[model samples]
Every structure is written in structure tokens, then in C-alpha cells.
Target chain A: MTELEKYIHGYFGVPTDDLAKIVTFFKPVSLKKGEYFLKAGQLSDRLGFVQSGIVREYVEANDKEVTKWISTKGYFVVDLASFVFHQPARWNFQAFTDAELYVIDQKNYQRIGQMVDRWHELEKLFIAKCFTVLEERVLTHLSMTAEERYQQLFAFNKELFNQVPLQYLASMLGMTPETLSRLRKKSF
Target chain B: MTELEKYIHGYFGVPTDDLAKIVTFFKPVSLKKGEYFLKAGQLSDRLGFVQSGIVREYVEANDKEVTKWISTKGYFVVDLASFVFHQPARWNFQAFTDAELYVIDQKNYQRIGQMVDRWHELEKLFIAKCFTVLEERVLTHLSMTAEERYQQLFAFNKELFNQVPLQYLASMLGMTPETLSRLRKKSF
Candidate 1:
């Protein structure tokens, strides 16, 4: 099975025959490093699941870019509000490195319901999972000190420290780059 | 139609018969002022839709209480993560006033899917709406200044300023009580 198929199967637990049908709706797409999958102000008509490499989602606020997330292999990338509600996108999603993705457009995404008996249940679970992840992030921001945030991120994805830019990571953690540098040194 | 039924009909756009079926699952419940709907460390087995008065969702962080939300009539109240995942609750949901709610336990919530053909679609939209609201909150917290946050909240729900405690509003806006006080003075 492809990585995208594995991820969908693992996350949704669709039967193999049904999973195969769902997988066909997603087409393989690639992005060169620094290329955008979607830009701010555009409607996010498609959702992409990363098969390899990293994608960064960020928004410009107060003339500075704030990183919202760094999605890597096996993670899905989309401006969810735009994708679901047809709103103008608020975040720009760009390839941090050359990336491969399995993408399903909005039309195809909706069509899955007709083909799969339990698609609504699976889709609800998928959205709920996304909501839970977001809630955890909000809790961390509200409760954690800058140092604690840095330590938690480090423990969760140490590889990101080496692979992604420090400023982006700092922004994602809601800390100044200088503070992140200080935390890194203190940790060592 | 009851307020809860109206809210369900408006939110989900379910047919009259189907809406009636959905409404039957939620029983009327009331809490006296200062009583808790749910507390930290308990599983959130039920979700409530506020019919009257207010409910507060807050968590103690580093010995300080951080207010996550002040839910009013026409709003749903639950530690969503705990309710959805069967995890121990993180926030304490207490009645900010003598509140009436239409509540559905997990078992009944699950049964709605079997009873209503389009229940899953309606449910997905409900969760998606929740996620979008959360995304907007995260964006404001990350991007807006304290004054800007206060101003936005005031414009959105001016009545809350008089109805809820200042300290709770301060915490909810991610500012100290002093900062909130200063902003209130400045606004006048």
C-alpha cells in the first residue's frame, strides 16, 4: 500500500476494498522546494496528504509571518476553513522541501460519501481528530511558559529543530527567536 | 418549538420529523448558580446546549485559573475533547448563573446516527463549525494585541462585560486583570 493509503487506513480503519476505492480519488502531486500548494486569499479547493517532505502553513500578521504548523510525511495539509467552507484562505501553505502528496479536490472529497457506506462516520471522526489536535495547541499556548513550550516541542519532534528554520519554529511556539535560542542553549 | 429544538433545526437544517427525533435525545437539565456541569479529571460523558443563563469553562494552570470560554444561552457546553474521546476532562464547566440546558449523554448522541439518515452530515458540519471557531480564536490570540483582543471581544459580546466577572474576562482575553481594567478605562 502507498503511504497515503496506509495513513487513511490507519486513521479511518476503512475496509481494504473500501479503502482502495477512497484512495483512487486522490492523485499524486509533487511540489518543488519553496513552491506553494495554496496561497492566502485563494479558496482552498483541495486537501493534500504529504507522502514525503515538509509543508509549512503560515500567515502574515502585523507585517510579520507567523508559522501555524509544519506538516511532514503522513500529515495532511490544507487551510481547513477554506477547504470546508469555501472561504478565502487565511494561511499560505508552501513546500519547505521537495514534497510528494496525494491530493483530493473538494468535489472528489464529497463524492467519497456516495461510494462508501460509512464515509460520514469516518469523515466526522477525521474532523473531530483535527479539532482535538487544535484544542491541545490552544491549551499549550494558554498554559505553557516559553521554556516549557520549547522543551515540549523539542521532545515531540527533535528532528524539526534541525530540518526547519529557527524563526518559523520560534513563531510556531509563540516565542521570539532570541528566546528560543536561549532555551536551546540552556537545554544543552 | 422549544429553544433547544429551534437551535437544532437552525444549526442542522434537519427535516421537522428528524429534528423532533434528535431533540428527544436531549433532556432538559438545570444547574443552580455555582454548580458544576462537569469538572476536571472526570470523563465528559454528556454535552449540553445552554437554554438560559451562562456557563464557564476554565482550567487551573500554574495555580492560576485560565478562562477558556463563557458559554451563554444558544451555545453548546462541554469539554469537547473529553466528551468526544472519553478522556478525563481538563476544564471545569460550572454554571455562571442558574442555567437551563438540553443535554444528551454519549449513548443518546451515538444513537442519533442510527435514527437519522443525514445525521452524520449534519454532525460533520457541526464539528467543522466548532473547529473553524477555534481556528479564528487561535489566530486572534497569535496575531492580535491585548487591546485589540479586548476590543474585538467587547464588540462581539458587549453584554458579557456586565454579565461575567472581570477577572474571568481578563483571563479569557490572555491579559491580566490590571490590563483589562486599563483597557476598559481607555475605551470610555
Candidate 2:
């Protein structure tokens, strides 16, 4: 199986060759560190597959930015509202590290939806994955104390903690870096 | 189209015939006010589609019950984590009014996913719809003030607001009924 097929299987566990045809419409592009894959008010033309490096998604509210999601290699990131609605995005996507992305536009996405028998299954798998992650996040914020959240973050993905900036990581954890620092020190 | 097919089509926008097959797999059930369709720590055996009446889903946090969602007529109500994972539910689903629900068990649900072509389309549509709604809820709770979220809830579904209890609605809005009342008075 190709890299594309491997990713698809990782998502859906479907190995039909017809699935490979769905990947043909995607175009690959590189994003520099600090560059945006998508910004507020611009349509997110595609859902991006990360081949390497890190990225973050954020939304501006009440004159402050709230980090919503962070991604590294073998992950997908996009302003879902814009991609699905074909409207201007309210969120922004930025590369925290130089990144390689394979992107599929809305038209081709819908084409694959219509033509591929397994596409809906794959879509369900993708949605389920997103929901599972989001649910875990909500639980963490709702139930855990801030310090506990920070410690869990440090334990689960030390690479993410090292690669992403502290402010952004703190934002994603729904805490301040000073608080994060205290917790990290408490841990050691 | 049958009554059941009509309701299914309204949620999924799929063909009536496809919905008819789906309807055959569902059992219609009714519950009186104050009754529970599901409870915490029980295995959620079925998913319910509300034809009429009200249901509220809540989880116990900090020894206080927090309502996560309120489903009225034409809404789907289930403990998704429990139903999907075959585990004990973390949430409670209780009827706020006499409720008519269409129910489907896990076996039929898996069958629908594997066998029906249009069912696949409908499933994707349903997942996408759920994702959009959940995403909006997360954003609204995170960004909007409690008063703003309450106002938006009433604007979106005044019928639900009128029928659901004040305490439940307040929980969903992340405020006390007294606070919601103050906001309402301030708005007028």
C-alpha cells in the first residue's frame, strides 16, 4: 500500500483499490512556518493532510485568540465550517513548523462522496474520530483541574510540548504558561 | 411516504423508500413525563428519534447535574459514547414531557450501514449534521456570554425553550434561571 492508502486505512480500515482513485484529485503544497493554510474570511479550499511538521487552529473572539486544535504529522487540519459550507472561514490555520500538505478541494471531495462506495463509511470514521477527540477535550476541561490537564499534556505528547510554543500550548490547555510552568515544576 | 419515513427524510434528506427500509428496523416507543429513556451507569441499548415531546441529556459533574443537550420533537437523543462503545452510559436521558420515539437497536444499525446504499448517504449526512451542531455548541459556549447563548437558543428554537423546564434550559445555557430571567428583562 502507498502512503495515501496507508492513511486511508488508518482512518477507515478499508483497502479497496477504488479508494485509491479518490486520492488522485488532491494537490500537494508546502506551508512555511508562520504561514497560514487558511485565514478568517477566506474559504478553506481544501482539507489538508499533514505529511510533516506541526500546525494549529484558532479562532478570534472578544479581542483574544482561543486555540481549538493542534496537529502534527499524519493528521488532517482545516477550517471545517468553510470547507463544508463553501463560505468564508471564521477560524485560522497556521503552520507552527514548515509543513507538507496534500489538499482536496470541495468539488473533488463531493465527487468522491458520490462515486466511492466506501466514502461514507470513511466519512463516518473520520467524524467519529473527531468527535472522540473533542469529547476527551471537553471532559478534560470540565472535570480536571488546570494543573492536572497540564501534567497529562506533558505525559501524552512531550514532542508536542517541545515543538509548539508555550503560549499556544497553554491556550490549547486552557491555562496560562505561568500555571503550566508551576505544574511542570511540580511534576519533576 | 409513511409518517416514519417523513420524519427520517426530514432529518437525513434521503429517499422515502430508503427511509422505509430503515423504518422497518425501528420500534416505536413512548415515555411519560419524568421517565427515563436511559440512565447513568446503564448500557444504552438503543438510539431514539423523537417524533414529539421533550428529553434532556445530562451528566453529573462536581455532584451537580449539567444538562448537555435538550431534544424536542424531531430530534435524536442518545448517549453517543455509551451507544457507540457498548459501555455503561455517563449521561442520563429523561423525558420532560410525554415523548414518542422511534428506536433502533445495534444489530439493525450495523446492518443498515453495511447493506443499504442510500443508508450510507444518509449516515454521512447525519454525522455531518451532528458535527456541525456539536461544533456550534462548543463555539457558542466557549465564546458567547451566558446571556448571549440563552438569547441565541431562544432565537433558534423558541418551541424548545417554551416546553423544556427552566432549570434544564438554564443548565444548557450555562446560567441560573434567575440570571436568564435578568437577561430576558434586560433585553426587553
Candidate 3:
């Protein structure tokens, strides 16, 4: 099975026929490090599922990029608002490393929405996951100190953090790179 | 149709039968201004859809309450992580007004998941809304000053700001009540 097929099976245990139908909607794309999967101001209609490497969603703030999320292998990466609303994106999606991703267009997404009886279940699951993450971040921002958030991040996604850069991670954690470096020393 | 029925139909637009099924799952709840909807450490199996008045999701940080999100009639409110994972809540949900709510238990939520195909689209729309709010908050935090965030809040949800308490609004804006009060004075 392909990597994308494996991911679907692992999550949904979808039958082969269903998986093939899903795959027909996808177009594979290659991205290089420093190249964007999707750029800000562009119309975003494709949802990219990472087969390999990492991607980050970021928005520029006074020339500094604030990283909002990091999408690793087997994860979906898209400016969801832009994709669903058919608008120009305020966010930028860039690869952190040379990567392969499967792109699904809006038409195909709606097609899948029509075909699968269990699609809603999967969609609900996806929304539930998004809510969980956003809630966690809100709590972290409100209640936890920067150091505490860093510790929590390590505890929550230690594996993913091991591959992410200090700068991008610092942005997501809502700390300066200098502060992150200082915390790193104190942590040791 | 009742106000509650009207609100649900406006948000989800389900058929009468499906709406009735959803209505059957909900239990009516009322709370005074000072009362809580759900406390920290409670299982958030019940998802509350606001029918009247205001509610806030909050957490205590250094003995001070930090508000996260505010829900009014026509909005959905829950400690989403707790609800999705079937775990105890880390945040407190409280009423800022004499509020009316309709709640659904997890079992019924799962039942709705099975029974309604459009329910998945509702879930997706709900999650997309959450992401949009989160994205906005993150952007406000990164790109704007505290005063700017406070200003943006009005621009984003003018009616909500009018209904919610200033302190809670300040909390959601990630500013001190004193700071927000001062900003409000400067605005006029």
C-alpha cells in the first residue's frame, strides 16, 4: 500500500475500493525546502496530505513570521478558511524539508462528502481534533507560563518537536527566539 | 417554532425530523449570572448550545480567572477536549447572565453522528468556525498590540462585546481589566 493508503487505513480502516476512489481525487506534488506549499494572497482550494517531511502554517507579523501549526507526515495541511471559503489566504504554508504531498481539490472533497456514509464521522473526528488543539492552545496562552507551555509541548508532542526548529517552535509557543534559547539552557 | 428550535435550524438547517431528534437529545438548563454551567474537573460529556444570555469558558491562573471564549445564544459552547476525549475538563464554564442552555449527552451526540448525514457538515462548519476564531486570535496576539486586539474584538463581534462583561472581554483579549478599562476610556 502507498503511504497515503496506509494512513487512511490506520485511521479509518477504509476498504480498498473506497480508498481507490479517494486516491483518484488526489494529485501528488513535490516541494523543496524553502518552497511554499501554498503562499499568502493566493486562492487556496487544495488540501495537502503529507506523505513525507514537514510543513508549517505561518502568517507574517511586521515582517516576522508567526508559526501557527506544524504539519508532519500523515497530517493534513491547508489554510482551511481559504480552502473552504474560496478566498485569498492570509496564511502561508511552506515545507520545512523536501517533501511529497497528495493534493485534493475542492470538487473532489465535496465528491467524497457525497459518496461515503462514514465521511461525516471522519469529518466530525477532524473537527473534534481541531477544537481540541485550539482549546489546548487557548488554555496554554491564558493559564500557563512560557516555560510551562514549552514543557507541555514537549510532553504532548515530543516526537514532532525533535524534528522542528527552535525558531518555528518558539513562534508557536508564543515566545521570542531569545527567550526560547534562554529557556533551553535553564531546562538543561 | 420556539426560539431554541429557530436558533438550531438557523445554525444547522436540518430537516424537521432530524431537528426533532436533536431536540430530544437536549435537556433544558438555566443558570443565574454568578453561577457556573460546568466546573473544572467535571466530565464535559454534555455539549451546551446557548439558548439565551452569555457564558464564558475560563481557567484560573495564579488565583485570577482568565476567560477563553464567550458563548451567547446561537453559539455552541463546550470544553471541546473533554467532550471529544471523554475526559475531565480543565476549564470552567460559567454564566455571565441568567442563561438558558440546551445540552446533549455524548451518547446522543454519537447517535446524531450516526443518524444525520448533514450532521457531519455541521460538525465541519463548527470546527471551521473554531479555527477561524483561533486564527484570528493568534494573528491578533502576534501582529497587533494589546490595544489593537481590544479594538479588533469590537470589529469582530460588536454585539457580543456589548452583551459580555468588560472584565471577561479583557480576559479573552489577554489583557488586564485595568488596561482594557483605560483603553475603553481612550476610545471615547
Candidate with the greatest lDDT versus the true structure:
1
The numbered model that scores best in DockQ is 1
lDDT of 2 by residue, B41-142 (tens): 999889898888888888888787878778877778777767776779888999988999999988888887766666665766676667766666666655
Query: What are the clashing pairs of model 2?
Result: none
Over A56-116, each residue of candidate 1 has an lDDT whose tens digit, in order, gives 9999998988888899998989887898789999889999999999999999998998989
lDDT score, residue B56, model 2? Answer: 85
TM-score of chain B of 3: 0.88
Worst 10 residues of 2 chain A by lDDT: A135-144
Instruction: Order candidates by DockQ, high to low.
Output: 1, 3, 2
In model 3, the clashing pairs are none
**Tens digits of per-residue lDDT for model 1 on B1-188?**
87878998888878888888888899999999999999999999999999999999999988988888899989998877788778899889999999998899999998988999888888888898888888878778667788999999999999999999998999888888999999999989
Q: Which ten residues in a row have the lowest lDDT in candidate 1 chain B?
A: B136-145
Candidate 2 vs. true structure, TM-score: 0.82
Best first by lDDT, ranked: 1, 3, 2
Judge the docking of candidate 2 as incorrect, acceptable, medium or high: acceptable
**Residue A59: error of model 1 in Å?**
1.6
Candidate 1 docking class? medium
